[model samples]
Target: MPEVVVITGGSRGIGRATALRFARRKGIRLALVARDETALAAAADACRARGAEVLTVSADLAAPDGPERAADAVVARFGRIDVWVASASVFSYGSVLDTPDEIVDRVIQTNLTGHMRAARAVLPHFHARGGGTLVFVGSLFSQIPGPYVAPYVAAKHGLLGFTRALRQEMLGHRGIHVRIVLPASIDTPIYERAANVTGRTPFPLPPVVSADRVARAVVRAARGGRAEVAVGAAQLVTRPLRFLAPRVFDRFIWTLQRTLGLRHRPAADTTGAVLAPMHDPGAVSGGWSRVPLRHPRSRRR
Candidate 1:
């Protein structure tokens, strides 16, 4: 029997790339879940052409019963789920006081609670089967702090703790594993689609890693690997900086976010993909690699 994989947020980004990678291997079946139907269809078709059985579920993971329904649908089609990837998350930018309540709630609901719901939906099956692998696609923000993205950072921190707890709980099951991949500034469409009310346009920082690279990490975790895998070389340095020199880390990260993360270019206040899906959900890569990273100075300055 082929291995069954259920991936959330499969419409684009790391999830889509992971699906394609798994499709390349023999004896694998994929079920892609996300809100964008058109993009999901495109991703599913691509995976099918790669010769892997594919099932696309167009559902929002933030919804109350969305994960449960998706899990049911996957089991109905694939019989069993061997791997579950929790990558369905939304992004937003603004200080806590500056961002609206609903936006923050949505980000937490989708990024943190959404993953929790997925665990609830799948753990029972894993327990029954005596084994399964659960991978959570987190961010470097899970440990290090950055300015203007407090809500996202908070959600990731919570996600990391939750994953740790799950891993501890699954210790008894020999075949069960809980893994988390923390990538720093991946070139995903998240920056373009994220809700921004800070007036300044946001962009991924220097050395933006490719989404496929992050996907490969996820693939390794699913197969068998370390419990925690942090992508990007900078992640290694940042982790220690947080402990060795807390003040220096704070000032350095804040300066970098101000100078490199957000552009001085003014952006009108409009919720981008916060309350709903993106208008044009682009492909896996956000093309940030082509654009050189520079200190975006204001014309007035």
Candidate 2:
């Protein structure tokens, strides 16, 4: 029997890349869940081309029953789920006070609550099977919060707490594993799809890692059952800095956000993909590599 994996946010970004990565492994079946039907179908087709059996579920994970329904459908199709990847997330760009209540709630629901729901739906199956892996695709923000992304930062922090607690609960269950992969800013459509309240366009801090890097880490976690893995050189340094000098690190992050995180070019304030599925399905990369990296001082001049 093949290993069956169900991945949320599988339509694009890290989820899509992870699906493709798993496709390379022989005898792996995949069920992809996301809101965009077109994108989900495209992802499933791509996986199938790589010779992996694929199922696409177009469901808004923020919906109360969405995660459970996806889990049920996957089990029905594949007989069992060996691994579950929680990677679906929506981005928000604004101060907590500036961002609308709806956007904040949506971000929290999609990024944090959705994962909880997925876990709830899968835990019973894992208990019955006597073994399974759960991988949460978190961010470096899970440790150190950044400015102008209050909702995202909060969600990541909550996710980390959730992962830790769940891991502790499964301590004696040798067959069950809970893992988390925290990646630094990856070149993904999240920046484009983020709800932007700032007058300027939102951009990730420099040295953006590729989605493939994060995807590979997630795959490794699933196979190795590592408790937690943080990807990227920046993440390595940031974690230590955060621990060594809390206030200084906070100031540094604030400076970096004001300088490198936003561009002066005016962009119309829109909810991006937080509220609705994007009309055009996104790919893994946001093409940030092509954009020249500008220094903060250079932007001012």
Candidate 3:
């Protein structure tokens, strides 16, 4: 029997790449969940081509019930889930003062609460089955903290905390594992969208890691039961700096923001990038404005 893996936010960016990586593994069944039906179908098709059983579900993780529904669908199709990866997250760039309340809510819901929902939804099954692997796609910001992306920073930190607590709870249980993958910036649309909103350049993190790099880490953790992995040397440095010299690091961040003119500015809608505030309806463009997106069919193949 093939091992079943359920992944959220599998339409694009790291999620899509991760799905493809897993597809190459022999005897792995993959279920990809995303809001874009078109993109989900495409991702599923690509995975299917690799000889894996693939299922695609169009779901908005930001919604309260979406994660449960996605989980149910995965379980229904696969009978059992051997792995769960919470890869769905959104970012809003700007100062804490400039970001709208709704955007904050959405970021929290999608990045933090949504992840919790998935964990809770599948944990019982994992526990009943005597073991499972839960992988979280955390960010470097979780440890280092980034200015002008306060929401993302907060959500990542929350995710780290959640992962730790979950791991502790699952400890001593045979066959159940929880771990996190922290990576520095990769060349992805998420960065472009964030840069577009924040009016900042997406530059290479010192020893920046690629999405594929993170995907490999995920694969190793899933197969070998590693507890946690950080993908970049940049993260290796900043993770400690954030703890030992938080104030100093924060000051440096503020200086960078000031030097870069990255203070809250309205994003231009022309870039096809999403902004914060209204997260559920979907991606938003321009400053202080949110564009609601209806769940679309899978668009990535």
Taking the tens digit of each residue's C-alpha lDDT, what string does model 3 give over 71-124?
Answer: 899889889889998888776666687666777777888889899989999998
lDDT comparison, 1 vs 2, better candidate: 2
Query: What are the per-residue Cα lDDT tens digits for candidate 2 across 1-301?
Result: 7999999999999999999999988988999999998889888888999999999988888999999999999989888989999999999888877899999999999999999999999999999899999999999999998888999999999999999999999998879999999998888888878999988877888778899999999999999856999987788778899999989999998888877788777778899999999856668888764563642323454
Model 1, 97-191: lDDT tens per residue?
89998899889999999899999999988888888999999999998878889989999999999999999988888888899999988887788
Point out where model 3 deviates above 4 Å: 195-207, 257-301
Which stretches of model 2 miss by more than 4 angstroms? Answer: 292-301
Top lDDT model: 2
- Flag clash pairs in model 1: none
The local distance difference test score of each candidate is: 0.87, 0.89, 0.72
Number of clashing residue pairs in every model? 0, 0, 19
Write the candidate numbers in order of decreasing lDDT.
Answer: 2, 1, 3
Return whichever of 2 and 3 wins on TM-score: 2
Better of 1 and 3 by lDDT: 1
Candidate 1 lowest-lDDT run of ten: 292-301
